[model samples]
Target: MTNILFVCTGNTCRSPMAQAIMQHRSEWNVQSAGIFAGEGADASQGTKEVLHAKGIPFLHQSQPVTDSLLEWADLVLTMTQNHRDLLKQQYQAATNKIYALKEYIDPDYEQAWTELKEAYAQLEDQKLVGKEMQADVIRKINKLEKKVQNVDISDPFGGNIMTYQKTYEELDNYLAQLVKKMENENR
Candidate 1:
């Protein structure tokens, strides 16, 4: 079975919600953690209410990302590009299996995303040598940015029930896509 680890900032909102959604839809071993979560905290109330309304059962305790958890996950999907990048930087060995959720599922954005990563790396390298921003690279980044939709799953930590529901719907849609992709790969 595939082992998927969903990640976000605090673990009380997005990641747990993702874990519940995926668990409800598939038999895969699924879990979630946060980069900076405190241990043993309950999921946010809005998260609980939304999941309950959808009839998706969830039991979660916030935990910070750890080496053991990283090792357990066959695939680590993050809520945002920043979360993905942070995990990649911290665990270079596991970089191959880590991706932002949208980036992993959206083939249309793949080329644009790759070029943007390369362009950002080049820009950083130039900065280290005190060079001015290259016009071509700047142009490339701007163009690619327009092509790539925001890959972040919306955070609903302090939002009302409606807000949390919207976020849940967004996640549910992408996760449905994820299920199809996984099934296709296994075929």
Candidate 2:
């Protein structure tokens, strides 16, 4: 069984919701934690409500991301590119297995994402030399931005139930794609 770990800024919202959704849909071992979570905090009410509406039961206690948890997961899927980068920086050994959830499931986004990163780095380097960003670089960045627009899942931490529901729907859709990809790989 593949062990998947979902991560976000706080365990109260996105990560736990993803854990619930994935667990309900697959037999794979699933768990979640946050990069800056306070231990034992309950999942947010909006998260709880949305999961209940979707008929996916979940109980969660917030916990900080730990090395042991990272070690346990076969895949470490973060809710945002920033979250994925943070883990990669701090836990270099796990970098190979870490990915932002959308980027992991959607291979079409991968090339654009790599090129975007390179473009951004080039832009930064030009700035260091006190040169203005070239028009071509700017255009490439803008195009890549559109292609990777959905790379990060929306954070619904303080939103109302409707906002939470929207986030849930977004996560559910990507997760369905994730399941299909994994199943096909196994086959």
RMSD of each: 4.7, 3.9
Candidate 1: segments with Cα more than 4 A from true spot: 114-141
What's the lDDT for all of these models? Answer: 0.93, 0.93
C-alpha TM-score for every candidate: 0.85, 0.87
Query: What is candidate 1's lDDT per residue for 1-187, written digit by digit as tens?
Result: 9999999999999999999999999999999999999999999999999999999988999999999999999999999999999999999989999999999999878888789999999887885343344877888899899777689899987789999999999999999999999999999
Highest TM-score: which candidate?
2
List the lowest-lDDT window of 10 residues for candidate 2.
126-135
Model 1 local distance difference test score: 0.93
What is candidate 2's lDDT per residue for 17-100, written digit by digit as tens?
999999999999999999999999999999999999989988899999999999999999999999999999999999999999
